[model samples]
Target: MDTLGALALATEPPTDNLMKRNPVGRREPLVTNIMWRNLFVQALYQVAILLIFDFDGVRILRLQNESRSNAEKVTNTFIFNTFVFCQWSICSSII
Candidate 1:
């Protein structure tokens, strides 16, 4: 047989045992739990930071001031709030 054929023949098909041997799958349950706990904690931290930085009285006042009329101001505020919510959702998914 050619070298390529010989090499191909030497490789065995994957099995459950092979999957079990993977380094990623060998982590302890405690390690996996800790990783998940950290991820949730970080996500909460990011949410808190975003809330602190993005939603302020000054920003609301600026939005209110930019509109020409009461109806326009309400519409503008609704759009701005929707945009902020969408941004937060995207950021949370990314993080």
Candidate 2:
């Protein structure tokens, strides 16, 4: 905890010693509270959940049924996220 505390303190204000110590500036926050505002009524909210369950999140989920022994396989969300990130990374690096 001391290390984190030191880093945080060091990064604060003119004391940006931590930022200098490791010169890469940390990423800024992407999402904010304003972006999370719900635009649905009570009726529409339930319908949205039903739609998600019926069609899935852009086919992001799958179920394995061959397991009589409780085995399962699942696509990790990070797998998709990383794929997208790498594509963007390569494209941006080319620039």
Candidate 3:
């Protein structure tokens, strides 16, 4: 019983030592400043990309059409086969 009690006490953390080691007051402002600076820089980069890149509505529509056509061609074979099989099964069942 004493050994078990000692083991339990050993497993528990020394909060007093940990509290002394931590410098929460000094680090919070530094971390918050870094986070704000990072966000500001990211916002500036996004604005620059929008201003300099060809990201207009017409270019977006053209890219969407090209992607759709390419995807249709890639999936055409499987789609056609499934449709034909479904139609054949329905006709055979009805007849």
Candidate 4:
């Protein structure tokens, strides 16, 4: 080959060698999948919070009114109060 032809050949990357050495195709990154999973988990967490704050609160209040004994009423109130306190603490800590 001439000097210029030899120089060009030397500078050019060998496509055949590259293709043979790395046969695997490019793959999608894991970040998108991980982000979607995190969003799903967060949505489930919000649903759980709604169930606890709304449905459970209503049920507890109803039960409190139905109970005849003072002891049972006090126990139910205490449990509800504790739940509220814990929920508040969690919110405050997160903020």
Candidate 5:
């Protein structure tokens, strides 16, 4: 057999732990194949939204509020707030 086939035969499936008892005898699920697949699907959805949908809040705001005098200030504040929110989200998810 090829090396990849050998490796696959040697290792249990990602969800094997969820299906069977671990060394600790707990049946709780850790990170599993389903979780990884869900994460991958979410990432693809986000990428599709970003690329095909062209959902830009700043552009929409500028187009909708052209007469507003504080457009630059509003856009700058929006960008800063978005950056902070993304940073917070990533950090929280990691923890």
Candidate 6:
């Protein structure tokens, strides 16, 4: 067997430690998967609204205000806050 085959054959399985089992964090659905998935979806929705605003279009945040869905509002707020923090960090690093 070659080096690649040898490495594959030598790999050991993970231990049965449920407490330290979160290897992928939010990417894998062990814990906090529902929250992460919702946040991701909200981020995508926010991005779509921003894209609409980019080329001389109407702002969608106003329309969101007219809706009675608390979940949607919370998701939009989370996405917006996440973006702002990212922008702040990027700008701070450059300054």
lDDT of each: 0.59, 0.47, 0.54, 0.61, 0.58, 0.55
Query: What TM-score do all the candidates reach, one by one?
Result: 0.30, 0.22, 0.28, 0.31, 0.35, 0.30
Error of 1 at 91 (Å): 16
Task: Estimate the lDDT of model 1.
Answer: 0.59
Task: Residues 1-95, candidate 5: write the lDDT tens digits.
Answer: 14555565568565766668546546757768988897787667655544432346547665455644476566656666655665465445544
**What is the C-alpha lDDT profile of model 4 across 11-50, one tens digit per residue?**
8877877768955556856468877896687667766765
**Candidate order, lDDT descending:** 4, 1, 5, 6, 3, 2
Error of 6 at 38 (Å): 28
TM-score of 5: 0.35
Clashing pairs in 2: none
lDDT of residue 23 for candidate 2: 50
Q: Give the TM-score of candidate 3.
A: 0.28
Kindly indicate the candidate among 4 and 5 with the higher lDDT. 4
Question: What is the Cα-based lDDT of residue 4 in candidate 3?
Answer: 52
Would you give me the overall lDDT of model 4?
Answer: 0.61
- Name the regions of candidate 4 deviating beyond 4 angstroms: 1-31, 59-95
Model 1 per-residue lDDT tens digits across residues 1-95: 14545466468577898778847554457457777887788678666755543555335545545545764555556656855775566455544
Candidate 6, residue 15: Cα displacement in angstroms equals 55
Highest TM-score against the true fold, candidate? 5
- The runs of at least 3 residues in candidate 1 whose Cα sits more than 4 Å from the true structure, single-residue gaps closed, are 1-31, 57-95
Candidate 6 residue-wise lDDT, 1-95, digit = tens: 14544465467455679448755655555547786886687678767755555432223344444545664565567556756765565445434
Evaluated at residue 23, the lDDT of candidate 1 is 75
- Tell me how far candidate 1 lies from the true structure as C-alpha RMSD in angstroms: 13.3
Candidate 2: RMSD to truth:
12.5
Name the top lDDT candidate: 4
By the TM-score metric, which is better: model 1 or model 5? 5
The root-mean-square deviation over C-alpha atoms between each candidate and the true structure, in angstroms, is: 13.3, 12.5, 22.0, 20.1, 11.9, 15.2
